[model samples]
Target: MTATPRPGRTIALVSEHASPLAVLGGVDAGGQNVHVAHLAAALADHGHHVTVYTRQDAPHLPPRVALRPGVDVRHVPAGPPRHIPKDQLLPHMEQFGHFLADEWRHRPPDIIHSHFWMSGIAALAAARELGLPLVHTYHALGTVKRRHQRQEDTSPPDRIALEKAVGHGCDRIIATCRDEVRELAAMGIAADRTTIVPCGVDTTVFTPHGPAAPRPPRRHRLLQIGRLVKRKGAALSITALTALPGTELLIAGGPPPHQLHQDPEVRRLRETARRTGVADRVRFTGGLPRESIPALLRSADVVLCPADYEPFGIVPLEAMGCGTPVVATATGGHLDTVADPATGRLFTPGDPAALARAVTALLADPARRAACGAAGRRRVLTRYGWDQVAAATWDVYHDVLALHPSHPSRGRSEVTPGPAR
Candidate 1:
């Protein structure tokens, strides 16, 4: 039902804060970084000339770097030429937009695919100026985050409104999960313009047959891998350790390993573990390298994803790809990927007792864990492969390009103000 993808088309990917080259599992660097990195590589493999435009986060780095054979990373100057928290980058979007507009004036891509809302703002400005088609993927929704985090949510006041505007204005919106489709509809994004494309895992890297990393000398190993933010529910994962006797928990993500002692959330989790009498059993490994993650996943008796909310968690898919059973919260993307009693166990979000019960159940049965792990691997191979995700995205690009063919007179020097929808 989709048109064949034309080769040699140039595509611009705009991600303002989450650079594809940034180290994964950092405070701002998590799923989006992995998603963009793999997606760009896969797209490049498919014969498209892909350029990823991200904010320049370091002073010493060059303006551009060849990320791969056909993919280029262009660092757009905005704000201070150094690292700044993603929440603080909203104020510099105007400068970011101007930079994008200037860049497009010289050499514009055939289509602009913006990731996250801030990137959408910049891309929208340039697209309007050049009459180029725009595709958007809001990796996470501000409205949902605000609802969940409430006072703790530090998102800019205009984020929700701006996200809604971008959702409605873009030519095509890629909803990374089925749950996001309903959320998009509620925010006034048209059903026809939105497409569901779940986040994928690298099957080649995450496999069951690989040599697993060495584990601590404990009866069982339970793993929790993600940022140490409160919303990620690392505390709950530590709490669950109290119920699973003879099992040691390995918390593998936060700031870099050397900087772990300074992270307040890590300190809080350590305190929580002490209070729960599991301090001796919980080990903090800090952040692991991407290359070491697959081995770590394979070493786990079970991988825990006890997040308060997740847009589309790549961790569950990665664990599944590694043939490791996941015990995840039953919310957001986890609902779509985690098959209850088949691939993994899911519990109500924020329930420490429920999380404990789920993990305890899995830890007690090796046969069930093996069965679930095998099923998960099969599910990932068939559905969540990066090749499949990139092919689907390519089809989307073809369709969007076909519908909105570029015109010779479209790129006239008209500096139109960005759309607020």
Candidate 2:
């Protein structure tokens, strides 16, 4: 067990990967980046001093960026101050942990919340040295990944075991979905410390419109956004398009086209499309600026997310916020976010036939699609807004503090109380 925060205690967020300011055009900058960025800003809005430490991906960068009134991004030097693929960064956790330990020697955080496994290792190391209370969120559990990706698992075999250890060792584990809670329990994590918090969306940016420009007559636009990877189910989405005639699938992600042919996922997806006989209908737009995503969602008739595993499905939430109905796999956060037959539909994971049915049904019926899209917009406003998500997170922090007092889990030293709001 660990001590809770004292009154006006400052907190540190350890995300060895996923820099808040990094562009989301790479394999690493997917959901975790959005999760940490939004959570930190939201927590700051609630009057808690927050310092988010991420690997420095560039040289000559400021040590901190005041993201909001109280939230700041601290670019820590772990490896080279340049982009390093996340999988390759695991071996550098020791260096990351040491950097945090050094930083805490002068100014320690009251509570440490680490995101992902490597970050958790860094957090655990720093906490062990300073007696800081640690909470962890395994954005994508290795066990879950192995099960979904199976023979395709690129993660080291020890990844699952390491994740399991972290899940059990942390003072508390924030499981993004109830299913994950069950999975954690099965993996030997304490059931008492687990909290279910779904990833949130900016509903203000993604809302339904009055009569969307009538989608192309005789041709439906289906959008699938995210890193183009096997685990993300990009290949499955392309295959589903084969079931719907005159349906054009737009795949948005990956580096620029000039450099895309070298990326394995992009090349694989293109090959899959050709093999499935839908290559003509599939368009890999590569990575577009994040700001352009809403318009892309609004223009599409249906958003496809057939991901095999999602700790929390942000894409579906973003689509729903944009008044675009989603057809996602009934797994992970998708189970919690998308209501089958209501806001959107869910198909069995990895089942191209099931996905085809759901997508084809949505594409063929304009009235049903419109109704579902409207419902999705309403749901996001009521549940997934950043304000609401932040408030809930604050409650968790307070609860932890109230439950433990003597331990003073602020690591070895205490950070100077800075303005967080």
Candidate 3:
């Protein structure tokens, strides 16, 4: 029997801090940026009209810019027209919501789905005015951040309480991983209120057949990409390198190369390399061009994502998509994405010895590493593509709309069943 096609609905994705239009690899730009960007495009590809409402962080940004066909990126003026850290963006959310309300007054959407917690707060402030059913996806929870970072956690004091309130306010919650669902349940949000939709990779961009980045011949190559935040475990990767001589590490994503020496974290990591006597073996390329990422991934002998705690990492999937074996910390989404012996290795988080051990084991056995890479590629192709992720997200929206009294699908005997995991 042929499966009936799912109908598309107008969607307003409120990602107040993480804009789909922002450049990737900055402190504020990472998975959420990629997530919103690709998800919007994929939804548009599925014939849905998408309007992404994000803060106008730059003075030159236009009010509404076309991202692609059927998609419009609407920049909402909240704080000053300049860069502001996401941690500090909360103060301007009410203003953000006011503008959102004004925009929706002119053009209301079928439903509003928010990306992160602050987006939920801003979305709720506006959604309440029109009594629109809102669906929320909290990319990371403060409780978890506090759990991992403790005193180092820079989230607002009321973040946990506000997040809980936002979760309750939303008609449905879309979690990015099973771990997130468990955390929400612990917060009194019922299991049924949340749906798990893993973040996806753009397979066309990250593939096994891409031109590999040129690197001087070395015994082995290890690459770590993403923001240079301390939690991302760049230091750990450097520390682990102390155990493997001649295996150089290439650190990507930070200020531009000319400005890299000025970056405190880069300075710290360099000092770490110097003190560990691996300074000559360590390299920093600063922020790479988007085109350079797949090549970099393809060039590495093994990719590393040793985060203190990841809430569904996009890097590992990207690495796996490129047919590179990964050595990720076994926490949060890594538990789901990397099949350990099947695709790559997962070691305990924050343990340099474990990371070294995993990398050593994978590197020492070429056959196992190649098998893992081949398996990883197959896993990404079958499961982690953007089409699968967007369809799951749309299913959650469809359910919300059908049950929502404001929607036309209400009173129907049955809406389509939820998407497969």
Candidate 4:
């Protein structure tokens, strides 16, 4: 007899702040948006029906939008239908949770997966009320942010406590890297409760074979592309530019060309370049067309990601996807992805000189850069593709579903949770 094919499960993804449809390169819109959108689409491609629930940021948005053949984007009416900074979104979690619980009560899904901490709060509540399986992925941990940003951290005061509750309450936690597992452990979560499913790159769009953007013939090019923010290390990269006289740094991402002059961070980075005496050598290419990213990545001799602290930074992976060598700080996910001296080089965070040294080394040796780029491409195809990520995530869903063979509404998960402080 032939073994019966397993039926696909319906899944709900809750992302309270990062709407899957938001344009990238915004102050708050970046990796999480990309992660949620791609994961939902990939799960749908895998024959599972998926629904992505996000805050209704615009009053004009329809209640439900068909994102793909098997995926739907549902707008949850929690707070005002306007842009609200994610750090200030915690007060709306109760309403968001109630809405989820009521919707699922009418039509339940097989799993509830949440992205970021605020979504975790809402998802945890809905899961508890409906006795549904919950999975959480904290794109960035509050403790780590506080440690790095200190007084600058804008998270709600109850963030850590609630994060703990969510970690303990959820059926499983999907961490993006090994460092996050350690961070979760420090919060009293056991390693068994968390699984690693990293943010993935779209390899088809980001391969090494694509045409590279034309560059300056005489000067070497360096690149750093993502949402232009202080913590992302644009300033550090600018500082490093002073040491490499023959190189030009391309700082891409921010408002469009006309609006770049008005952005505070852009102005700040410009001032940094000027003060470092590298203003002539630095260029700011405003938000680029998504289709042009692979070309931009290919044009760079070295991609710099010297973030103060990265929570599985996707830029390096994208750089790797384009067969570009990365020089990232050895912190957070960079430690996991950038295999030192192989795929790329790693330096200590916040050290501009060290960052410069790494970049200089990569620029000096063309063969080394090529070998690293090739290795980087191989690594991305093997480990960081969305299909692989989706399959790994599906395994987590299967394991959790197996743990709850009976209807979830009739019972809760039997796994013993670590104490939530």
Candidate 5:
């Protein structure tokens, strides 16, 4: 048998908070974690040796676990060997960067790609010290948050400014949508340094004609998946369900219902449903296994996403892949993904009345729903599959490596260069 040459050497993925192995179906298992994990597996399939570094949240977690043939997870010791929320992980970036630097001292990876703000901070610091090429993907921008939230936003006061710095400092910014490129430019990130690479879905798993598992029989089922946060706009969907009689709204995210009562957002959602006289129609599924999400989507008549803002909403994409139509707000990435009158309907963000009207119209017409679902599945498979996303990301890595080769002191190639480069 002939030997196959390697493809541009090893690459490191830095994700401080979201571990690839962590169960999805929680408050934090929205987009970033899925993007990183799927992207790594896809990249590995393309013959790249990939190593994902995430903060170790449990002592029992192995130091390394193979995801695919060429992909591995590396649990780096940062703060405590226990779970810590994303909001509390900022102070440990310096330690994360130091650990990364030490890891690179002996077995250096060709390039480092970081996900989220704190990961970007740690990766940038480590890259600067090691003279390594760095690529960053900020799942959500702070500038956008401040613009959307104004005074009510509870994010750290300095998040906007710090995110701006990360965007400008990184070797290249991976904008998940064209809208994000505009947001980055507004925050002073050079347009030329930004590449638009949207997150992708696994079409093989989220197919249109698959046999969906049995779901509770209801007059009609409307699904909403993601965190129970103000930005997610789940409460708006719950309120809208009241106007559409006989429709069962299943919310799939967050902890169990008992634990949910402890959350202010969950309580607010319950209150909104009661005020709208739809509390009985809405059911919170709490958190379900990630493997079970596709089946859930397949059984839904319509998927609802009323997020106030999103860099790229993966829930709608997942629904689309499962041959399900969506009713999402025309904000941020939703405007790019959902084609009005084609794949699904779109309404103004924060307008429950408008959202209710859209959902009502979809529920009234079964043929229209079928047609839209077919179109949505075709759209995702054609343009937003994991293969396409992985290739695009690899291209970015190659471009960065071509621009910067060996360190000034090392004088040897850290990452293999193409013949011409």
Candidate 6:
């Protein structure tokens, strides 16, 4: 049986590449950042002391920064104290692990929750040394990415093997969706040890009664929001715009607003829109403020997500929360979240024609769109609230801590303690 969690218990969240403090919509910053940020805040609101340990990406950032009343962000020194692509940070896990071991020796957490595969590797090492229970959530699986991107995938060669090891070693695995459970099973993770904890939305912020953001007047509006990566299928959405004659497609998220033109993916997408003869119809609003996203979603007639594969998409839920219907590809988490012709529409992955048909149908009928949007908002309220997500996650943390009681004397060293710098 699991032990009851005490009030004020400290929980450590390890997210190596996705810092909670980073701005959203950048190449390395998206769903994972939002997930970690919101989860930490929710856990803190539950009266637990939460400390998020993330890689120190910039030299000017202090070693520690308070995120909220009960939440703190600890900058773990690993690799160069500067931004580096997530793929390149794999080789630095050993250094990250050692730093964690040193830090925990002074003040260990009751439980450690690691976010990505690399963070899992680092946390696993420290947990083993300290005899502390560890939980892991792989935001994206290497096997799935490699399968989808094939030659274009740039993940480390050993990511699959390392992930397999981490999956086996973790006390509990939190699968973001049912599809992820199947992938985990293929990698030898037992079904009994894994739990499905879907990503959530802040319904208070994303509501049906907000003033919509301003946009150019068009017969209908189609919106796509995510990183400007090839696998995200933003280009596919651009192609679909050609078929929807009067509808305008708004692509939001890439580099910062100032640096959008320099982004390689943005340039590629621009050319694609030009080639498809929809350049004038498509607008790219690069990296809008996080607070403005709900307004942006509300402004859309229909939000679209054309990802080739997604573990779990927060955007669709956000749109749904805003009472805006979504048109998403029938893959990954979309299969679980979207109810066809009810909450939103779903089409085959990578099919621009199918996407166009769904968008046109939704746009042509205002009543159906409003009905779908209402149903979607209802789904989000009852199913995908952050409070529920945090409660489920806390249950997992308690389960792990109960199974493996910590050994306080094991991690502390005989040598004199150094200054906490």
Count clashing residue pairs per candidate. Answer: 0, 3, 0, 0, 0, 0
Off by over 4 Å in 6: 1-5, 405-421
The C-alpha TM-scores of every prediction are 0.96, 0.90, 0.95, 0.95, 0.92, 0.95
Question: Which residue ranges in model 5 land beyond 4 Å of their true spot?
Answer: 1-8, 213-218, 405-421
What is model 2's C-alpha RMSD?
5.6
lDDT of 3 by residue, 1-421 (tens): 1122255668999998888877677898989989998999998998889999999999999999999998899989988999999888878888888898888888899889998988888887777767777899999999999998999988877777778878877788999888999999999998998988899999999999969998878579999999999999999999999999779999999888899989999999999999999999999999887888999999999999999999989999999999999999988989999997899999998899999999999899989989999999999999999998887887887787777866422321111111112
Clashing residue pairs, backbone N/CA/C < 3 A, model 1: none
Clash number for model 2?
Answer: 3
lDDT of 4 by residue, 365-397 (tens): 999999999999999999999988988888888
Compose the digit string of candidate 2's lDDT tens values, residues 261-291.
8898888888888998999898887887877
Error of 5 at 183 (Å): 0.9
Q: Model 1 over residues 1-421: C-alpha lDDT tens digits? A: 5456678889999999999998888889999999999999998888889999999999988999999999999999898999998888887787898898898889889889999999998888778767788889999999889989999988887788788777766778998988899898888776898988888999999999899989767479999898888899989988888888899989998888899899999999999999999999999888888999999999999999999999989999999999999999998999999999999999999998999898888988999999999999999999999989988888788777878746633422222233222
What do the candidate models score in CA lDDT, each in turn?
Answer: 0.88, 0.80, 0.87, 0.88, 0.83, 0.88
Candidate that beats the other on TM-score, 2 or 5, i.e. the better one: 5
* Residues 1-421, model 6: lDDT tens digits: 3234467989999999999888888888999999999999998888899999999999988999999999999999888999999988887787888899999989999889999999998888888887778889999999999999999888888788788888877788999999999999998888998999999999999999978988777468899998888889999999999898988889999887789889999999999999989999888999888998999999999999999999899999999999999999998899888889799999999899999999989999999999999999999999899988988898888777766645633322222111112
Give the Å shift of residue 128 in candidate 4. Answer: 1.0
| Candidate 1 positional error at 308, Å | 0.2
Q: Of the candidates numbered 1 and 3, which has the greater TM-score value? A: 1
lDDT of 4 at 299: 97
Model 1: what TM-score? 0.96
* Top candidate by TM-score: 1
